[model samples]
Target chain A: MKKLINKPEDVLADALKGVAAAHPELRVDHQHRVIYRAEPKADGKVALISGGGSGHEPLHGGFVGPGMLDAACCGEVFTSPTPDQMVGATTVVDRGAGVLHIVKNYTGDVMNFEMAGELVADSGVRVETIVTDDDVAVEDSTWTAGRRGVGVTVLLEKIVGAAAEEGQDLDAVLALSRRVNGQGRSMGMALTSCTVPAAGKPTFELPEDQMEMGVGIHGEPGRHRVPIAGAAEIAERLVEPVLADLQFGGSPGIVMLSGLGGTPLLELYLLFGEVAPLLEKAGVQVVRSLVGNYITSLDMAGASLTVLKADDELVRLWDAPVRTAGLRWGV
Target chain B: MKKLINKPEDVLADALKGVAAAHPELRVDHQHRVIYRAEPKADGKVALISGGGSGHEPLHGGFVGPGMLDAACCGEVFTSPTPDQMVGATTVVDRGAGVLHIVKNYTGDVMNFEMAGELVADSGVRVETIVTDDDVAVEDSTWTAGRRGVGVTVLLEKIVGAAAEEGQDLDAVLALSRRVNGQGRSMGMALTSCTVPAAGKPTFELPEDQMEMGVGIHGEPGRHRVPIAGAAEIAERLVEPVLADLQFGGSPGIVMLSGLGGTPLLELYLLFGEVAPLLEKAGVQVVRSLVGNYITSLDMAGASLTVLKADDELVRLWDAPVRTAGLRWGV
Candidate 1:
């Protein structure tokens, strides 16, 4: 695989420096490997924080802003950020109200963030967390660290971040975040495998005419491999399981058809076109929809689908304004 | 260049059906190629709307929710959606306050959305628009339609969506959206070209050792091609121009370092690592930062960086709560 970097070993350090230079509002604690909003949130606002392996961009870090996370701890390319890094983020962003850690359901992520949360809690800062187990792949996949936190992490951050921004207590924010996670389900597929910079090769080999279905974001093997089909068939492979897992037909829902980094918007939209009608046929009403590369795998050519059931209140909350580097709406 | 469609012609239609099925809350007006929130916004709320080609998924459509766009028009892959589709979306979502159209800077996207706005205005609906021209790539280049909208569109949608969800007047929303576009700039680099399914080939060929800089999201050629460099060098290539274009020093700003589809998160984070300190050394304070794949090329292996200068008001709005499929925060 071809790559752009001076040395593979220096990739992480070099990229962090570039990020700090490009974004003046973000402060990089290079020593701790954390990226945060330069100006911390107002005192008393519950700080929402998250982190994980370095591969998922705009995720734990891109999301650091006023309406989203207070700080993000980043690990080295697909490696979990060290516990020390998470502790540093939690300590820096904590403004007294408390801190909530939004952890994806990966073993390393969970372990690292949990350790950080504990370390911070020991310092008497309130720290609460919600683990996002949205990917319906498998609890113990051969390729992934575990059932990876795929798409729903985006939803959880936004929802929980909104709660924290509203000055909600830590427990309330944690509850709402957990609720959103509980109600959401996601599944992914990969057309082509990605090569980790460190691994220096495709994480997994996919045949030219086949796709890995139910793949996790971290280059994990999916539930099955099938002959690559049209956008219509691919949509079925991604959406059917999501619907079946959550029974989205009974109520209004919010659906996210996300690209796994390498898929084109054309194909994603085409997939949406195919997925939309089938949802309606199934008696589901999509109150809202989002398509893009929200939570992504490095450069894997694929997409993932996530569904969230919404009541009137959640819908109202959904409509609220927010400003963040990655997601800004209603501002 | 390998794709899975049964027939190239069936891509769009088949995909829409699948979208409708997976996301029941969103209704896909197949005839019009519009994806709308199943439930319209309250009466008198300015309807926020956006559209472009189908390839940039979860964009105009995925953003349709309470705090974001009320509806989105989708065109064929990499091609702008038709005026009729935009017309339909504007008409159905309009609640008397007016409609705001968020268009990217591409010529086709601008022209199509403009035509749709005209059609809607003819029908007696008040419409306003903001065209995002954030990509710093040269305009009217050999391979590009124009400076591609790139990453700033995501920021515009969220900020403008927040204003509209607050029941701000159409003019207010339009102004805010435009302000975001004006304050932001983006530049991208590609390691490998993507294959548009219809084209069934890479958009462009780059020698394995070379990379394309200042590339656009639609597989457009970039400003220059050079032998691939290390993460630090690549970071400098992407960041220098952005910093030169705007004065990021003195005041805090928002920075978005996004992957153009195929770049891995590990590389992305490494890129951020290189960027963070550069901004700090320049005496720029980063108020917010985001690193990820929001806007993308089909499957091009590259990344982009976007910088937006933010003020107190923008920062406050950024802190507002939002709930949507793509962006949810401050719940």
Candidate 2:
């Protein structure tokens, strides 16, 4: 219950105000809750847009800028953005090349983004949507019918945003987005449940001596609870499933060890130490590894591993200069 | 305490291993516990070195890279690094141009860095030191003689590091560091106490309905305990003292609303929203503002606000491209 928020009901709006205050480079649509670049890209360029809940910050909203999403629709805590908000963001950011909706595979998000896409089409703008379902945690969790999208969305936005910034057509950008999504796999665990601001308590009760093995970003029950383990063992649980699901050894891999909000970077670094050697043992050639909180579950003390099988093209795009608030490098 | 550590003693080593694994751009000296740039700067460059307790990550360690500290000495959690570690790091990174020790104003840190400077001088390497005492929480707190160096050290490192990268002499860099320290002030509050792994419990008891106002980064008791307030009121508490101590108006400013580890970005942004306008109304022109978990007190749910009065030269240095884990831009 000890969170740095005003009223639970006012979290999103207040945070957006902070976002606007901190990053004057971004234009905050206070009414629709969309974050757009202060200057939209020139005409005849692909525009990228993404969003889900507000809790996984630096994800959809923080990723908006040059070489990333042109705009990000911000929803409420653990809730999808409404079609109206998506449409408003799309209209503001779209150029002649059209807009792409990068929706994570959450039922509420998917359904809403689809409806938004159709609505945008009625406005005479072309829209392509890519649904990313890279989380290997569970097939069906508390909020989704399939694998829940997790960390891959951050990587995909960076790489695909680079493609869009390079004047790639909507088709090419969409193709690259889908490729990165398919090549990336993520697995996460939670030390404690994140208390949704609206909930006023932890989303779920996790015993003091145990952890959720494969928790979702929104506190969805993971595979099961297990007794709390050290960073080394926790690394095994996070990396094993992602490696099993994806063959990362044959190609250069882009890996990320992202904190689930509440975990400090000190511990996240410790987790990466446990996870990296195991990936190397499996013959995974990690060309680029990112360790920090990029995508997060609000105030959840745990870390997640994302392994993206990268070829030269993907690595090149990933290396391109990105100026977003969350992940910025090579610029 | 449910933390991702093998043992309290091993946390620093394990996290350093992870730092090596995740950041190939940086080199790790295991035995001495130092993080240095993988490629040292050419000889005859003013080298910047910083170290403190390991808990406030990305502070001293994460800032080591191209345009920041040449090497960062890593200490145990909440414990200042030993003089031996600092001496060893100084020996390795001391180009002919000498090294600058950026020490925070903690009793242990200041004393140890002073000892290390003398030891480094014994090796015939020129050394300059600057002590940052920007925290306005209390004139004299648990481990500080004056104001505790809370968040201003981060800004000082970046601005002064950039000056060093441009090959500023030790005297010039030292002067700039002093200027930054004099112009900046910070105040922080804690929603809850951080639990040190070694202690296996919260540092202190904080009731669910109260907050520690003006809390130090190391969970040192702030000026007083206050009833929990809204982000607007909390922002006022953090911003008022900083502005009162330093006149930030009439010139460009660099403001950072840094999370104390455990808080999420959503809330940090919300807090920033509440803080920015108040500063503006008070006549502060925040030319650059960074909001995130840059300096943290491991898993402590709170935040600190730093306002550094900057001039044209400092603003230019602040905008320079620097590659470090915590802060980066304008490459």
Best by lDDT: 2
Q: Give the poorly placed runs of model 1, Cα more than 4 Å off.
A: A4-6, A22-25, A142-147, A247-249, B1-6, B12-189, B212-226, B231-260, B264-297, B303-331
> Where does candidate 2 stray beyond 4 Å?
none
Worst 10 residues of 2 chain A by lDDT: A243-252
Error of 2 at B87 (Å): 1.3
Residue B303 lDDT (model 1): 79
What does candidate 1's lDDT look like per residue over A137-238, in tens digits?
676775346566778888778777777787899888888988888889888888888778778888888888788888888887778898888766877777
lDDT (Cα, tens digit) per residue for candidate 1, span B212-245: 8887777677788998887778778888888888
DockQ of 1: 0.30
Provide the overall lDDT of each model, using Cα atoms, as 2-decimal numbers. Answer: 0.75, 0.90
True lDDT of residue B290, candidate 1: 65
TM-scores for all predictions:
0.71, 0.98
- Looking at model 2, residue B327 earns an lDDT score of 78
Each candidate's clash count: 101, 2
